[model samples]
Target: MSRNPRILVTGATGRLGRLLVPRLLARGAHVRALTREAGRAASLAADGAEVVVGDLGDGASLRHAFHGASHLFLLSPISPELAAEQIAAIAAAKAAGVQRIVKLSGSHWTIEPPGRSLSGDAHAHIEAALRASGIAHQVLRPNAWLQVTLARLAGELAAGDVLHAPPAFPKVAGIDARDIADVAAHALLGPEPSATDSPWVLTGARAVDHHEIARIASALSGRRIVAEPLSREALAQRAAQAESPYVAQVHAQFAALIGTGEAATVTDTVERVLGRPARTIEAFVAEALAA
Candidate 1:
């Protein structure tokens, strides 16, 4: 893509969007950041992005945002109908003559165990939409966020000595959100050629289980920690009590995955994309514990 092309970024007010917009601007791309809440678009405006009020569910709004845009950064939020929302947005982008789209598809979760499940189904629909639109696109499937470990292990980290849930042997290939954002930004503004349409999987440097994370946190904080396991049913009940139906469902699914140890495999996808090793769990633990 040319430098300073009119680029439209959906979900610009989100976590990745916040970083992605600024990164694109640093590459000299003029951006229109689309958000459902106009007030929250202030950050984008401050970062030299043209803020547009819009929703993925509304075709007219998406059309308006896609207008006069050459490249589109399509980031569908985590939801059951992510694919449908993305397809609608892609249709609008095609009508607006957009040339490129960078989409955040499924995670390592879906990639490792491909099926007709919710996450997989949603990503499939999005890919279908991009293909049907005949738009040049890149699909990124990242691994589970390191934040998941941080979120669950925060209390332990703060106290400087405990593993809140999961057995010590439970392993996961945890990735940092910032790294994922970097890869997304790189793909959005990087050189494109015959290799533009391939699917890229983003990941952190290493695969780590709770025991390793606990050890890292211990080293970082200079304290001893005890790893403890929680039952899947208990975690699900806790999630349900927290009033997050979606999280409850995910927790139950995760419990099943954990039982099968299907989440243990690690991939070299991040190295292929970024031309370097991904961040390690130790780095994540140190960074998150400090935060």
Candidate 2:
């Protein structure tokens, strides 16, 4: 890879992509951001990224976006069409002669049986397609994002000192999205190419259940927070009131994985890739509360 590879970053306006674009720019990489809405990409454009309007559904547009790009950071939102869109993007990338691809995948996906989780299945399909494409690729499979998990309890935390969730939710070493982005930047820019068809499973320093998360949040927020376990029916009611019925069903499936303790497995992949310890829940809580 060249010192200043022309990198194409998809989903630039999303959480991880927003963090990633700036980091890539800081390293003197020439970044081209692909977004569905050009207007939303203004900040990226202001930050020296060549923002291009494109849609994953449009093959011609994807080809245009991939043009002249040596490296591709492939990220997409979770949807039923996710696998199809990523496969399309992979084809475009290969056609454009892109040298490397770093894909954002999901943790425990390899262990998941078919039809376990919709999102996991979609990502697994995409990973298979990438391998078949024969591109030099690296996959970052991160555990449940700490920010998303905390956001679910934000209202409860603000109203009182109790954090509630379904009972028997297993421990998970949830990782910060920023840490995932940092590892991605390293993989995209590092001289040694990542092992082909290999994936890096990222996690926090240690696994913790909701009780531990509550304690950590309380310590950081200067409040005495306690964990309140709820029944499956109660959790269903809460999910129904909070989001669409379909989304609630999806959440239930993921919660089932946690209930089974599958999401708690930890790996030292982040430290191995970034040469630094992964961020902890305590630190994430402190920074989030401060912000």
Candidate 3:
């Protein structure tokens, strides 16, 4: 409850947690980072945060990770067993006297009325667990990440080939992952804002149709890459042919959501939280392409 609480961050070796740890330390929070690999601890230690080797499934390791920490950052990625993993982490945080939790949730997924989709269903279960755990917390449902487009299509784009997957007509707002981190950091470290308990639908200040994203990507790279729309079945087939298992699953999920037009809506949570306009798709593409 005091300023600069001891914070335990799960998934310290991950994209979001790795970025979050440094920011938390900058705010003077004593951070204990949890990573499955002992080798990864050096990086966190180098940054002046305590690193504990642990897994979300291993209760003993989690207990060690949360010892003396007053706040927990929970970001258990979606998988076949996400609900169990999140529940374990939440239980450990509650038992260890952790004061608050900041859960990283899916953007367009919802299960309030009991949807059959895995993401929606799983996220809802996890949220219910967090609520039941009785921990003071904030839930951030960030919009579809703009960075995934680069990461997922890097090989295809690098070869100057068209990304033949979903339709370019679907309207989806792309939010930068950095903005998500900024909001999470503010919630964890800033003076407790009045809406900390509320669910924040974080999104870019503006929405960009997929067609525009494809056009901008082509312009930035000097190559014409068409975003070919495909049927749900065709998209699944394409994902199955991809080299990375992660990308394959993601494409399949996005294809389904886009088909249903679930991801087309936009929100202004980023502006509401950070008091500034969020980054645009063009800016994201330009920076990523340059990188």
Candidate 4:
């Protein structure tokens, strides 16, 4: 890596990438954010990041984006092709002489031995590729996101006082997306590279169930908000509305893992990496409400 690394970031328009890009820029790194649409990256280009429009499925675009990059921060949308696309990205990075990479991966709860979620299986395959590629890399396995898990409930609260939660584990320690972004920035810009063998698992400071989340919302909104469990039919409809067949399968797999023990464990990885306690659910809800 050069004294000043030029970092190429994929999924730059998504929630986590939007947060990570500015953090990398603040650290004086040369940030090149990739998007498939030129128009979507207009703001990124305006934010002093070198925005490149590319697709993981498109090799010419990947080559163009990988040119002269010292490191790659890889993230892809949820799809069945995730493993193949990311593996190809690693190969392209190596061919471009990019020596280091950081990958945002699926949390442990979503994973199983095999034939589970496409999301989990994809991450496992890509992680294996990273090991075989010999790239200086670190994988971050972030737990359930507050933004994805609860922000919708908060948004729904604006219209009604009830949250229709699907069946899930009793208590889940969901981490904030901001915390994950911070860990990613550290992994990418730290003084030295982390071992590729071990993945960093991220979680929030505490675990809380849907009922507890309702209480928090009630407390924050100063109104009575209830968490009503979604019926199996409603849940089935929700899964049916997924964007693709592969994603629908992934959602079904996720639904199957809801009652497992893995979803409730909390880790100190965030505090260890950033030297501060992890962000809390209350804070995440407050921010969601404010937004």
Give one digit per residue, the lDDT tens place, for model 4 in 41-73: 788888889989899999999999999999999
lDDT by residue (166-276, candidate 1, tens digit) is 643667777777778778877777766243456776666666677777777777787787666767686656767743566356555665664455556677877777787
Give me the displacement of residue 171 in model 3, in angstroms: 2.1
Per residue, candidate 3 scores C-alpha lDDT tens digits across 191-266 of: 5534335688887766566567678888888887677665778755667786567546645665567566666667
Instruction: Estimate candidate 3's alpha-carbon lDDT, on a 0 to 1 scale.
Output: 0.75
Q: Which RMSD does model 4 reach against the true structure?
A: 1.7
Candidate 2 deviates by what RMSD? 2.3
Q: What is the C-alpha lDDT of each candidate?
A: 0.74, 0.84, 0.75, 0.86
User: After superposing candidate 2, which stretches have Cα over 4 Å from the reference?
Assistant: 153-155, 194-197, 220-222, 230-234, 241-248
Measured against the true structure, the TM-scores of the candidates, in listed sequence, are: 0.89, 0.91, 0.86, 0.94
| Tens-digit lDDT track of model 2 for 1-291 | 655699999989998999999999999999999999999999999999999889999999998999899999999987767889999999999999999999998676433677888778888889899888888898888988887877666567657787775588578888888899999999899855645546778888898988887888987877888888886687667787744555566677888787888778889988988888998888876765555
Query: Among all windows of ten consecutive residues in candidate 3, which has the lowest summed lDDT?
Result: 108-117
Ranking by lDDT: 4, 2, 3, 1
Clashes of 2: 0
**Candidate 4 error regions (>4 Å):** none
Candidate 1: residue pairs that collide: 205-278, 205-279
Assess the local accuracy of residue 193 in candidate 2 as a C-alpha lDDT between 0 and 100: 61
How far does residue 102 in candidate 2 sit from its true spot (Å)? 0.3
Off by over 4 Å in 1: 111-113, 152-155, 167-169, 193-197, 231-234, 241-247
* Root-mean-square deviation (CA) per prediction: 2.5, 2.3, 3.2, 1.7
User: Which number leads on lDDT?
Assistant: 4
Clashing pairs in 2: none
